[model samples]
Target: MPSTTGSATAPLRVDARPELTGDRRIAVLLSHGFTGSPASMRPWGEHLAELGYGVRAPLLPGHGTTWQDLNRHTWAQWTATIREVFEELSATHDAVVVGGLSMGGAQVLRLAADVGDRVAGVMVVNPAVSTLRRDVRLLPVLKHVVPSFPAIGNDIKKAGMDESGYQRTPLKAVHSMMRAWPQLIADLPQVTAPLVYFRSATDNVVDDSSEPIILGRVSSTDVTRVPLPESYHVATLDNDAPTIFARSAEFVARVTG
Candidate 1:
């Protein structure tokens, strides 16, 4: 869970124009989770690129640095970063599918709602917007008293593999995200793009609280839920990652075709 500094944590963009390539030229925007950097998603991005898809994974604001700096960023900044990447990709790419992990999932849902059919499709891994944790009830006051809590990073079942995220959780940033859930949920029906949700059967960081809400409210009649039994919350970096990578390529092909 400890932070690590390297090019691995930097933002990644793999450009492959449709004019040069063929059907696989569809672009995909991959967003990382909160307290997590691009490192967590780099492998998946690379995999998609290997399949001939253009890929981008942006480091959210205040991430790839320190947890203390993460507290300085709000949900707006984080969401804006993803939105910007979508805009950038949309400008050149004929079609762009948006996807994310954890908080990144929620952020892409926001984009799906905002841009509607402009998004070719949607994919999410362990996307979380709600929690069953009881301690969050005290965030209103506790955020002011305590700066952060223990790390929620490195919740992977994969041994020796780190998510390369913060070693601590920033309470203020946590509160900001939690506060925006109501609006995000309210806007769920606005999301009409085809959605493929990749959820881990057992996740330590994000519970099943968000699944029902997203699946039930989304207006997209075309929805598929794939369960990953062999991984934890950071399933993108876990054993079932290949399942995700392969299925995700098929998903992009299905939606973009």
Candidate 2:
């Protein structure tokens, strides 16, 4: 059963706990996408936990709450939350693999760049570093007037599946993310950890532009790009979720073993 214990001020979905496995020596920090709660990464975290790996799918600072709350926070708060968790895990774990979906992916990439060889490996699904949309250029001015736009969640091909993310896209928060993009791209060369990238074929949110930018800039020699044919943007809950789980397990073993 999905636990509904969060307050109205911060409504968390069922299965959105900061989970951990019995084995704490090897940890995996899994991050959910922007505007998304830990619910989006819960299934993937649980699967890894079942395999005796430590998993932590933390809810970002402003997320799992109202969209208005997200507008009040910036990308720095979100990254700070993940950095604290990663540092905590890194202190005790012999090896750590950081993985995320969408914006979560970008977060992990930034971590990998900052931490370098300390991160055993990296995995991401539909990671976004840049946008192809022209409207994004207007964000600097539009954000002042527009509180939010349409929601970007539930981009899954699997029918009836919900990611349990925010219902609307907070323009102010989106602008903060945009501000962080250039820095993330600039630091990409610092990331040398083994990377396993999963790209969905029909993603409506993140376009084809992001993947090439990441692959071209990263210094990692061990890089694998897998295609998710059946899934959409949020592939963690989509059809190829099993593939993601299985391949991720293998990727971790190969790099950390």
Candidate 3:
């Protein structure tokens, strides 16, 4: 598998035709994590697509390729890529719901803040935001000294997937995620849409600080938080993934109803 670095190189495109939008059904844009591909969210996307919603699980910039490609891009480029997909989805559907797994979660939160009124709701699964802990702070420094550390949870799911395996985990890419965390945390207060937060109780990567940050910032009284009992960092593909997908479908249904 190759790493995507947001360069001028052509992307590994997945064509999701707007087959259900003729009846003016809702649209949902599903975003993947930092080092992950659209395969992470395709099951959930297909679930929603089957429920009369148009779905698009776009491959984020610098992903579905090599880790070296990811190292070449920053958070800004990745967010812009998701944003462009959202804009296009919104143009064709009666309503739009934005959601993501991990970093894709941050992009949707920023999108909700930037265009809350335009979005119907948001659903985040094990979203990563703000890595201020001493351990994460030391990662940037360690990268300089250590040649390469295989990123934790960089493996892809073999079930219901249609893409290459996990690509490279670039040190520069991880550092960029750390840098973007603060801005995402700072901008959370501006979001006003209904939200569903799925947290993996045993997630090894993201800390628990995200719960308070999300609860304190969002203005929606209808926020729902569900704890995944058997999942790790990538809850969408973990042991309890079915639960996550069901909750996500319910969240979108509630908001769009």
Candidate 4:
């Protein structure tokens, strides 16, 4: 695991109170995808801060370094860091909305399920809970045999946008992420907070399967699904990112009110 829960490289954290919204002090804590650093979520977080909301995008354990480091860390290390960030935000802000990209999205959902109403809302872009790949079933046995494979990051439709994620997919870390999916899918009903889901219409990385599971299962009556017609997996750095930033701010205002 990385020495610090979140290193300072390209970190994004802004403390601001809205001059244009409700009386509640709200903050948005975002998490990056597996093998991804804070760079991916920084732009979105900055946009929220410009709108006068406290924003935080923390680097996960075993990220921002070599793929070998990621393999050494399990899903537990990543989840623990997210849990720590959420608790701190909840203590400081009147309300906190948790969100993320890819695996980061699942981490936030787990927190929402555990903490229930304490999480004001959720905003996920290209979140992955389960995969259609049959090879994944063999991860438990294959992870020891094979260390890693090609990365699933930077699947953007934009011309030159880069997610700056790991070049290799660490088997141990990825297997750990998928291992939590079954339980999370079952606990989806426990997440009752308002949800704003953004998914790229065509993604080479994540399929359309997880969307139905999340949209159908989460008990959030205020669920809103926004399809990114022109983007791919890393929608945060793609053409539709503005829409995500704008709508997410609105979501915060509505739920935190």
Candidate 5:
């Protein structure tokens, strides 16, 4: 059976070449969340690719690995990597649309703000924009005084559903995300591309505050919010994934056309 646990040494690759032709179609750059691999975005990318849209899902830095590896990298590294991928995709295709899961979604928002004119549209799934509470403020202290493994399983209710099954979340990694949150929140108003926001009703990772923060702040004239009622934080791999894939395909088609 194929490994569902993901990998640290080996990164997941999107089977994108088969879907690409010389049609000069719109390009789609898919980004995964913090601690996630390109595999997380593969379904959406493949679905878009099948429709003759060029799709690319690049693995973020320090991801597809153990939590310790993730702790070693900063949010900026991941953002830079995705930005480069977005530029490459935009240069190669006629129109460019960017999408991501969780933190990847946050990064995409930053990308839209920083390079709005270069992008045709944006598709975000459970984009994390705000901290659920000030308690996240404690992360900085915990990373030094406590071990990350002991507290790892406490946050996850559906252990069986964790594709990576990571029991050890790098304390520093969670802290890094928290630090990045403030900047993403501040940059929300700069986004000018048409936006498609997908949210999971049962998500435990990102709080409900995200919807208002994104919907109320982004400057995009066309902002569509779709609720994923059947999935959790990793909705891309859960029950409503097909909905995400299909909706994303439709959104890409409409925006890029």
Candidate 6:
């Protein structure tokens, strides 16, 4: 992974609120990954907002503050936050697209499954649904003994880019995410919204097995997978970011048109 100059010990950046344009008919609710703040998704949201689409990238409950904050939050609270934003957007927008990165991706999938056809489209980048690593399986027990681990934030392949996520990984939160995975997978068949999935060719954090699990299980007939050749897990901030922003905007237009 490419390295940046910012200090991981520095304070997390503030969350980015929805930048609403005059055109409220089209709205997008984007969520960042588990430990990540809205900074990772703000650029993407701003691009869409510039196109006259209303975009909201809410900070997850425990993110963008401290690692201890994340440990205090659960998977249910994370899902609840996104769901509320999605519902609010749905009320005003004629079309709404729910998207996220990594864990955020799984959260949006759950939203699509819960709301079904109401969602105009779904977008995900380097979605983490299932992990092939046996180590994650130990989360249930390990979380009790271990309080934290090395951070998985800032997995970008681009230099000088700061994701502003937590400096450490909270084991309790990781355990909560792992516990929710099975239910998310089980609900995949109910996700009938059109989907555009972006998978990185080389991701150091999320394993390759995750892509197949999501693609194979989702019930959406209208699905497209684009390969991010030069990016890693945080493709939103990597060299291929422009590709994701442009394609996702096009996808929204196509689905909502």
Cα error, candidate 6, residue 248 (Å): 0.6
TM-score of each: 0.95, 0.91, 0.84, 0.94, 0.86, 0.91
lDDT of 6 by residue, 115-197 (tens): 99999999999989888888887888888899899999899989999888888999999889988999999989999999999
Error of 5 at 221 (Å): 1.0
Per-residue CA lDDT of model 2 for 66-183, tens digit only, reads 8999999998998998899889788877788999999999999999999999999999999999988999999999999999999999899999878888889999999999899999
Model 3: lDDT of residue 50: 67
Residues 1-257, model 3: lDDT tens digits: 12222422223233233354345568788888877777667667666766667777776777767777777788889888878978887776678888888788888898898886799999998777765467667777876775345665533233443323244457777887778877878888778889899988786767787778878878777788888877777777777778977888788777876
Model 5 lDDT per residue over 137-170, tens place:
7888888876464323222233444445255667
By how many angstroms RMSD does model 2 differ from the true structure?
3.8
lDDT at position 164, candidate 1:
83
Considering every candidate listed, which one attains the maximal lDDT?
1
Tens-place lDDT digits, model 1, residues 43-94? 8988887766788899899999999999999999998888898998899788
lDDT of 4 at 49: 80
lDDT over C-alpha atoms for residue 211 of model 5:
80
Instruction: Please name the candidate that would achieve the greatest TM-score relative to the true structure.
Output: 1
Question: What local lDDT does model 1 show for residue 121?
Answer: 96
Count of residue pairs whose backbone atoms collide, per candidate: 0, 0, 8, 0, 1, 0
Model 1 TM-score is: 0.95
lDDT, residue 43, model 4: 79
Question: Candidate 1 clashing pairs?
Answer: none
